[model samples]
Target: MNKKYHDVFSRLDQKDKDLLREYSVKNTTGVIFDMLKIFEEHQEFKFIYEEDGKQVNLVEISEMLKAEPLSEYGWIARFSKHVKDHEII
Candidate 1:
């Protein structure tokens, strides 16, 4: 694990760990970078799962759709979409 992202991955649960394993256990934090580079363009996390020939997705809702501002919407959803979902980003 890279020290820079230790704080991020540290906060995730075991299931999320398993999800990251789909990326690779030796470099799980790569998914975060993928999310920033790819998913941000579409408002949700998605990447090619080449072995399975399908896109793996992360559940993320736009703060604008929620009733609260970013900080308070975190009170409701960080990753809350139901579409082709895997876990909260």
Candidate 2:
């Protein structure tokens, strides 16, 4: 992984860290599915199309979630809002 990416991952909160660890250990497909489940309810979470015509995937989303320059409390609040808006656990 890139150093910047690794740095981002290293700074994740406990819950996000746990999720990353779990997803890394499990099937990538399952991880993607779970991400979609979360994203579906969060309008702010959307696919970013690249010039190469590739759609953003779960790994990228996870990286973003981990790297967002917000306080732990802010991250949780946003995450909770997304969950509540989408009725996701």
Candidate 3:
């Protein structure tokens, strides 16, 4: 695991961590990166799974990623839909 991402990596549940580790071992590129792109674009942590059969929302994931050093930057921006140019507030 990369030291830079240790905080976010630690925030994940063991199951999620294990899965990420497995992906790291099995893939050199593409799959995991694509998955990250999809996750960030979608902005959801529980996007890949359900808890007690309930769907997870962006707010929860945002809170989780908020403390990560790089999460508050561009990496998360890609997940958000910019409507500021269209919506009049």
lDDT of each: 0.48, 0.56, 0.52
Q: What is the lDDT, from 0 to 100, of the residue 27 in candidate 1?
A: 50
Give every collision pair in model 3.
Answer: none
lDDT per residue for candidate 1 within 4-53, as digits (tens), equals 79999888898888778555623534444453455446654443334566
Clashes of each: 0, 0, 0
lDDT-superior candidate, 1 or 3: 3
Segments in model 1 whose C-alpha atoms lie over 4 Å from true places? 25-89
How much does candidate 1 score in TM-score? 0.25
lDDT (Cα, tens digit) per residue for candidate 2, span 16-74 = 97687656635543554566556555767765646678677543566454334243453
TM-score result, candidate 2: 0.27
Off by over 4 Å in 3: 1-3, 29-89
Candidate 3 Cα deviation (angstroms), residue 46: 46
In model 2, state the lDDT of residue 34.
Answer: 64
In candidate 3, where is summed lDDT lowest over 10 consecutive residues? 63-72
lDDT of 1: 0.48
Span of ten consecutive residues with least summed lDDT in model 2: 80-89
